[model samples]
Target: MTPQMRHRLVHAGWLAAALAALGGVFVLYVHPDFLVTLVDQVWSCF
Candidate 1:
């Protein structure tokens, strides 16, 4: 892969991880129902 592609892939992976972490926090502190909703939202993008 090209350098630009590699960088973009890494960035995307980090973004996905960050979103998942946020979802975990919401599920822990706000509402458990958000966990499934957020995960499904994330997966639906791809």
Candidate 2:
């Protein structure tokens, strides 16, 4: 592939990865149990 095409592909891949991560976080946040557990775990660290 051309250099420009490779650069675009890399940028697109990063965007896709970020979107997937956000989606995963959104799914987790949609569950009340997950948020409670997460808060408990964080609170335990202090």
User: How far is each candidate from the true structure, as Cα RMSD in Å?
Assistant: 9.0, 1.8
Error of 2 at 19 (Å): 0.1
- Residue pairs that clash (backbone atoms under 3 angstroms), model 1: none
Please give, for residues 1-46, the per-residue lDDT of candidate 2 as tens digits. 9999999999999999999999999998789798899899999999
lDDT of 1 at 17: 100
Index of the highest-TM-score prediction:
2
lDDT of 2 at 30: 85
lDDT of 1 at 38: 77
Task: For residue 25, give model 1's deviation from the true position in Å.
Answer: 0.2
Q: Candidates' lDDT values, in order? A: 0.89, 0.95
Worst 10 residues of 1 by lDDT: 26-35
Give the poorly placed runs of model 1, Cα more than 4 Å off. 31-46
Scored against the true structure, residue 1 in model 1 reaches a CA lDDT of 100
